[model samples]
Target chain A: MGVIIAKSLNEACVVLAENPATTVLAGGTDLMVQANRGMQSMDSVLDLSRILELKEWTLKDSEIVLGAGISYTDLAEPQIATVVPALAQAARTVGSPQIRNAGTLGGNLATASPAGDTIPVLVAMDAVLQLKSSSGNREVAITDFITGVKSNALQAGEIIQSITMPVFQGPQEFLKVGTRNAMVISVVSLALVTDYLGRKLRVGVGSVSPVPFRATEAEEFISQEFDWEKNSSLSEKVINKFSDMVADSTKPIDDHRGTADYRKHAVGILAKRALERVCANGES
Target chain B: MTSEIYTLTVNGNDYQILDGHPSESLLWVLRERLELSGSKNACEEGECGSCTVLLDGEIVCSCLVLAASAVGREIVTIEGLGSGNEISDVQQAFVDAGAVQCGFCTPGLLVAIDQLLNTNPDPDDLTVREAISGNLCRCTGYGRILEAVRIASNSRTVQNEEEKGK
Candidate 1:
């Protein structure tokens, strides 16, 4: 195998464009695991960690423009917590501080794992990703970008350059249940965002499906069926019905962490918890 | 593989390696090349905090750190703590509090606590637990480490007060 040392983003892009078969290495958190397990083989490798342009993060037009290479450590700052608590929450739950500092959002997007903790939060926010190649750049929504489990619409030679998400007015939260307290992968994860303006609700359930997905049916019921204009009180029957709907929407497969039924049940519990938190915050 | 010549200022000492591979981890380089055996290599997969080290004043798993990627940076291992040929205050506290069980997890725990107390001296119990949550210990159940951090903080505070009085 050969390695290409890229000192700049442009150089990395050019290298990726030239060697379509080369694997791009950002933080090496994900790639190292694959390589160690003999899950990947490549003719070339392009190291992108030294590219400073891809590591920046800023705000523009009330939207957060996050560089793809911004580590979870960078996003866990107090400023990000104030502006985008959901993202910050998700970032805080990611592995340990060491992994948080080394892992990049682009790597998560590239992996497209159903268990990717931050993707659901990004999806619930209607996040857009900027894809760049030697040719040019184009923006794509996160939902459309991820086609399936471990499958993505990213074309060859294109790298995720940046991601943008709107700053919404309502409350949002990201939750996950892992094996242990720290440095454990999710068993079942959830990202719940409320779009209060249009009376629209967004719910995303991860680790319970092929890819992180929205609970549209339950979302509809919570936003429309409930008579919130008169009273925000919800009965047990209603919550049970919503949980059943969430269970039916997911297509989880039994894996090492949990059974399909267990994951479905956990997702339902997480959805209910998320709804409770959102409603509890509504009063304050 | 193409390699880079890098100089790392580690624990007030400088190391110059000519063939540091970018993907090669710093833990092995520190142990094998430089012969600093303080950090353990248990669970090289980053799950166990046995390879914990201070990189540029932050606790990070040395197994996951690429040696060439840490150029022009500062690193502190377990050996760097305390005075010359003596343990630091925190290390002494750990021993006093019976925090060392099998001692395999001692180096990483010491490094983890060193970074934490150095940054946050008067951390509460919950804060200490959170700070060292990444470090795992098979024996002792972490009751001793908890007591150790608190005791170390209190002793340090008292020592400071005595100096001021004098």
Candidate 2:
């Protein structure tokens, strides 16, 4: 076994280009666990923690570009929380303080778990991922990046460089159901973002499908029904209908964590609560 | 297969890992190679914080950290908590509060509480609970552990005041 600690992004890319089979280690929260359990073999490893470029974040105008190595603890900081409250809320719910301090945004994106706490928030914000390799860089939407459970569209020698999301001035909420309040994987999660400038509401649902997806039908229904000018609330019937539509969009499965029926039901309830918290003014 | 030698800075001392495999975890290297058994190894995974150690001043599960990745980083295990032969204030508070039962989770809990107090000297109950949520104590049911944190915080406040008087 060999380990190469790359001090910069260029060095890391060169290493990856030379040997595409090298296992990239960032934070190592997920990969090391697999290695400990004999589930993953590391013939060669590329440690990315020393790369200074991946640890930085930039805010340009109305968009925020978070470096791939930004930890969940950093994401929940006041600097990012004010701009992306839902992402901060989701980051705060991931694992525990120890995990959050070590787990990076790029690690979460690379894991591509359907039950990942932060993915739904990223999807709702329509985040674009910057993938870089020795050859060049490419951008992919969050929806197109995650292909299935524990699967992603990352090619060999490619690394998630940064995640870019547009800042919006509206109420945002991230809600999830887990067995325990802390240190538990989400059973079902939902993120709701209100785009006041565009007069559109976005909804992202997770843990109930193969990939975290936007509840487009429910978003469309609520966006059409709710009055954006006055920022009025929706009736109880409308909320319920929107929740049902969100539930109908899922393709859940019965797993050790939860049953398909329970996941669908929980996701709908999460969607409903998220909408009420974000959009419900005083009516319902 | 060739074994590579790497130097790890633990508890202000540099130890050369001559027999460690590249895939070995930091927890394994700490306990097996360096003989720092104070950092308990309960769950090899990150779920149980029994193997918690401060890597570069941030508490993380040593089991989830690759030993090779931690070459140049500073690591503080439970053995490095106190100065000289004296147990730290938090460790003494745990003994005073009877927070140790079976004692598997004590080291991790102490490290977590130490970090919490370092950041926030006087944390509320919710803050304390959230701070130590990663550590799982099957014994004491967390009642004594929480009590230990309170005792540590109070003593630290008194100590701070005394230092200010000087």
Candidate 3:
């Protein structure tokens, strides 16, 4: 296969415009697996690994703009971990040390796997993706960009440049349940970002739906029931009701990793536990 | 298929391959063209760290790295850890702790431990487990492997203090 090493983001876009069908190789964690399995055959590839501009993150206004090329290893940086703990926690659960070292958050979103560990966290944080092409640039929300399972709204000649999300001020938690402890795909993952000052919370769920989604209805219910100023603890009844709402929102299907019933049950348990942890440890 | 010439530095040696493809995995080039078979091809996928190598001092699965993409980068494979006939401290620890059974997974484990100890000489049990979690060993049950890492870490600490005293 022909591969062009683009040293800069502008060079990458120009090459992409010329070879729109060429595969974009970022970290190659997912694409290389397909190539090794004979699942993908490509005539040309655009290697973005050499582009330095795509590897550095920046803080703009009140949001953190992470370059699409930032690896999971970068997510563990103290600055990123403090601002986006859920994303860091999700990155930690990605694969093993080797996988995290090479895998990029941009690659994870581009793959659009429903079971992607970081997708739920991105959705919870309302992350925005910047897609660049020779023509121009456009921004899309994480939910809209990830159209379906193993699919995204990436246009021809376009590549993900970076992802931006508002800085979260409250406590955030990410929880994933897999068959084994490490190096396993998520059966159901949940991310909770609690805004105690705002008297509300944001919930993002993955693997239990066609796309990772926010538990809006569940969030509305809990926010209404929660007394932001006075209540120090959540009642057992409220936790049960919130968990039930989260389970009810999912539209899961049976697959090799888990059954629909198990996914739903697991999501409920994860939601309850995540909410409890946030309530117990959230900042006032 | 048209072939591409890719140049890379592996284990302190410079190499240029005429038949390396940009899409071909680094694991294939290492095992086939360069004859560095120390990095095993257990799972061509990234799930198994059998093809683990140090890419710019960071551990990454060679199976997931494209040979062309690795051009101008530094890579350290299992065969590059020691000079000539002498083995690295981590490898010696594996032998002393009886960490080898079938020995198929030994090379990857040795590379992983070598990288881990370089960064953290005194890692806890959880750190050791996390370091080698990508590597799967069906024969040793990982008990001796943990012990081997602990032994290597202790030995390195002792050697470092001696050097400092001198």
Candidate 4:
């Protein structure tokens, strides 16, 4: 059987409560491909695209709450672009205008693809995942949200309502090395958010592991030993420990995109380049 | 399965259609149900912009768009470009610029370029490149494809002046 279109979130929850055998469709960045290949085994689907309530990006104090169904096209507007340029850059990097128009942050989190463009950026910016069920709502840090590959802390009958994050310090850099530029998935992607400056320098890396991660060790190393202005031996220290630390944190494999070694090398290059940019930013 | 009827406005005309499910993709509805073959189904996964169409004054891949979700939205396909006889300035520019090679990805390209020129009448080369980065044409080197955008934008200017003269 096909799916039923739930006009509202309440109706969708009722559908989930009664018949939990439904797959929820937001942006079909991941779902449509799975459905075409007959991988998604749900007998029914709850189409949340029609639910207007699930599509808003608003500001609550310092937090920018992007609705579960908001498309990159919606976020590409000039006003929305100012929220977070790096996040916007991540959104623009998705695939193309069509992919951006169709994909959702909700689907990205739900699918939990390691190469999910926005995930690393969110991780760097200390974003939160807001999941809502028929019973109530709950929020989890993005770091604690994903448990494993394609497995998350989400319980049954729960759907990601929106993703919330404070508008972090800017001039942030988000870079990914892919096969091509626009459409191809990343070999490795890195997001550097200097929200704290001397307070903290958060670095998020994706496609190098089962889950995108912030290199806490590397962050500590930079904070303690390094100064961007003076003569820096920390570059050598960072390069020395970065490869192993980044590789140790990741669980990459030989996929059609690349091999584990290539991923490791990419991770190292990404790290050095990212910190180099940070240093450059500091210089500026 | 329960079906939902939605009023879809295509180009300028409005048509009511039955959707097997409200969540069904508009690409399938447009290609299979409505028989609008202008947009090809290259990568039904929304990677290739072969299925690109303008949805409610913006560009989107029809493959990833839900059929029932498109209700009450204005859709502009390549077929909607010109009046009755003459092709649109952008479409003509594509032809004049020799942008088409295999012609498979042309319709989506035309739609994409048409939308880009509407927003940025005089765009730089980089802007033109970024705007249509969604629509991929593997045949043409994309040099000529971008040239067509510039050509089309120039055509819009000349046509405006001609009308002003009358």
Candidate 2 regions with alpha-carbon error over 4 angstroms: A280-284
lDDT of 4 by residue, A1-284 (tens): 35567788888887777776677788777877765555664356677877887787898676798888888777666766777776777887888876777787787888888888888989988899888888888999998997778878887788888899887644567889887777878888888776544556677899888899888877676556556344234566665675466556666689999998888878877777766666666556
CAPRI rating of model 2: medium
DockQ of 3: 0.71
TM-score of 4: 0.89
DockQ of 2: 0.73
The local lDDT score (0 to 100) that residue A92 gets in candidate 1 is 84
Query: Per-residue CA lDDT of candidate 2, range A79-189, in tens?
Result: 999899999999999888999999999999999999888999999889999999999999999999999889999999999999999998788999989888778888899
CAPRI level of candidate 3:
medium
In terms of lDDT, the poorest run of 10 residues in model 2 chain A is A275-284
- Compared with the true structure, the alpha-carbon lDDT of candidate 1 equals 0.81
Q: Which candidate model has the greater TM-score, 1 or 4?
A: 1
Top-lDDT structure, candidate number: 2
Q: Name the regions of candidate 3 deviating beyond 4 angstroms.
A: none
**Candidate 3 TM-score for chain A:** 0.96
Clashing pairs in 4: none
DockQ of each: 0.38, 0.73, 0.71, 0.47
lDDT of each: 0.81, 0.91, 0.90, 0.78
Better of 3 and 4 by lDDT: 3
Per-residue lDDT of model 3, residues A1-284, tens digit only: 48788999999999999978888999999999998887886458888987888888887677899999999988977889988899999998888999999999899999999999999999988999999999999999999999999999999999999999988667789999997777989999999987765677899999998899999999999989876775567899999999999999999999999999999999999999998888777535
